[model samples]
Target: MKISELSRRTGVPVASIKYFLRQELLPAGRATAATLAEYGDEHVQRLRLIKALTALGGLSIAATRNVLAAIDQADSSEGALGAVSYALPVPVAAQSAAGDEEEAEADATAGAEVAELLAALDWQAPGTSPHVQGLTSALKELRRLDARYAPGELAAYARLAESVARLDLERAAGVDDPVALAERAVIVFAICAPVFELLRRLAQEDQVRRRAAGDGAEAASPR
Candidate 1:
């Protein structure tokens, strides 16, 4: 396919496609002549991956380029199929439920919002996983309770999630086997979430109780 079709099919502009090629983000296609070349389905897939990285992965072009190169290089290697260079999962969202307009749009939009916010904040909190989606649902509940609230207000919770991410990475560092490390990381890390939330809630309740007791004692004292 020509560059024009590549742009049409990918929904990305032709100039942006050329810019990606020039930046070496996409590999050079077969050189048909001095000024033109043919792009194949592989090129289409690569371009899609590039856009996905930007749109879903929340990576800047420079970061996307580096990640693409790393991925491409890894693909060329004879390493075991399960081996990965980084701890991050591939940037991808799941297929949404069909035949439900509101449900689908809400999920898709929230996924995009979550991706951008997470990438911008450099948070790695399972952007498309069940946990993040549940978090998003919780956020919607928050919004319904107070329509004035915005999603940005909720991301402050990242301080805790990131604290967990740090702890998770440290725990994984002690394990050498990739499978065992991943298994423990996901399983144990997920269990920590509810416990951590409970601790925070309990601490807040204790503070509230203390303040209430102080107020009652003051009220009971002679004026």
Candidate 2:
């Protein structure tokens, strides 16, 4: 098909498609003449993946490029999974007071707490993981607010996270195509994250209502 046909079929504008081709986000179509080229089904699929990453998954072009490279170079399922994992954005930790000794000490303490928590949970994430940084930052904030999770509570949260991760990996393993699997990983998380949060909020509301009406199992049980 011609570029125009590719653009029409994909619902991507001609200018944008041209830009993608120039950026090498979309591969160049087969040159047919000085000013014309022919695209195929693979181009359509690639364009859809690019749109999903940029438009729906909210990845920047650079990140999208890295993810695409990962897909292209991946030799195994684990390699593809690792590529997507590393390409995903990490949450940046908030900065503290500049050159303040006490603030530095507090930050160090939070880092220690994060390490301890991860150790207790038996998670083997790298020290450089954004999740570790984010958790350390959150722990610092909790200390500032004089609020902290009990060890048992933190452990429970870790267990739940592990279960969710296991389910995600299982689903990813089912896909035969590495590129499609990588795309699915990003799209599934983007779409399901909000839905998961909403379900948690709804469950909280239901619990509150049940307690207020003295109808919950815990509310009805002997105190």
Candidate 3:
């Protein structure tokens, strides 16, 4: 297929496809003539993967390139997952916590709390992990907001997060192709994070309504 056909098939613009080629995000096709190239099904698959990383996964060009390289180099499922997760941009709060001198104490406290939470759950991850660091930042913010969210208060949330993560990993584990698995992980995390937040808010509203209705029913009943 020509570049135009590739664009048509993938719903990507021809110019954008050319740009991907220039950026080395997409590999060059076989040369058919001095000014022509022929793409194959592999190219189609590659384009779709690139689209998923950038569009669905919301990765920048540089990040997408790194992930692509990781996918190509990965020999196993864990390697692919590591590459995908590492290539994701760190949360802004976590980045700020890492650099801000004012956050040092809070970061340390949050780190200790997180360590305790991890030990309680028998989970292992480096303190420097982006996910761990992100959690530290969030815990720090929560502590700043209220004394109610003290060091040990995150255990319940952490347990729920672990349950969700286990389900995600189980689905990924069934995938045989490392590249496909990486793509699935990236897309699922990127899309589902916001979806999860929205669902939480919806559940909160439902709980409030249910409690309000129960109170109304009790008030209307005879003593």
lDDT of 2: 0.81
In the range 45-95, model 3's lDDT, one tens digit per residue, is: 788888888988779999899899988999889888888887776664534
Q: By TM-score, how accurate is candidate 2?
A: 0.87
lDDT of 3 at 50: 87
Pairs clashing in candidate 3?
none
Residue 165 of model 2, lDDT score? 81
Candidates sorted by lDDT, best first: 3, 2, 1
> What C-alpha lDDT values do all the predictions have?
0.60, 0.81, 0.81
Q: Per-residue alpha-carbon lDDT of model 2 for 78-156, expressed as tens digits?
A: 7777777676665555665546887898889989988887888888888887778888888787777778787688778
Residue 173 local lDDT, model 1 = 63
- Give the lDDT of residue 145 in candidate 1: 44
Better of 1 and 3 by lDDT: 3
